[model samples]
Target: MADKQDLNAGFTGTPVEQPEGLAKAAQSAASRVKREAYAVTAGARDHPHTASALLLGIGIAAFGFGYLLGRSSAESSASYWR
Candidate 1:
């Protein structure tokens, strides 16, 4: 078996260090997303009826869009022998 150092000896690239600002930026962005998600959850919990209505509307729209798309595609490839 080859040693670990022997295996790594093939690559001579230097290690790259991440910027301090990049780490801070990532942490801030993650925290912001977490806060926003918590707020959305709280809002939905407080307004269950609104959230349900919104979900229903989105579902209906999605179904209609899918039906239209499928119908259009099917028409384009329809057979004339029927």
Candidate 2:
């Protein structure tokens, strides 16, 4: 046990080196994401009615699926008690 060194004793604040091209690839990916997000926002703004209708449909489908799942679980537990 005496031979073990403290874990924090070797710590240094220097930035770690990254693989070549990793930084450039990350920057390009970020820019692509930003462009896509901007395009989505512009499209939604240009077609508010379609976006709202799509959102409403998604909400209804999600609620129905959740309701079915909950109902099935409740029925199974009730039957187990009997």
In the range 1-82, model 1's lDDT, one tens digit per residue, is 9987668656577548654798879978999999999999999999999999999999999999999999988887786435
Q: Estimate the TM-score for candidate 2.
A: 0.59
What is the lDDT, from 0 to 100, of the residue 38 in candidate 2? 98
The pairs that clash in candidate 1 are none
The alpha-carbon root-mean-square deviation between model 1 and the true structure, to one decimal in Å, is 9.6
lDDT score of model 1? Answer: 0.88
- Where model 1 places Cα greater than 4 Å from the true spot, the runs are 1-22, 79-82
Candidate 2: list runs displaced more than 4 Å: 1-29
Q: Please report how far candidate 2 places residue 17 from its true position, in Å.
A: 8.6
lDDT score, residue 70, model 1? 99
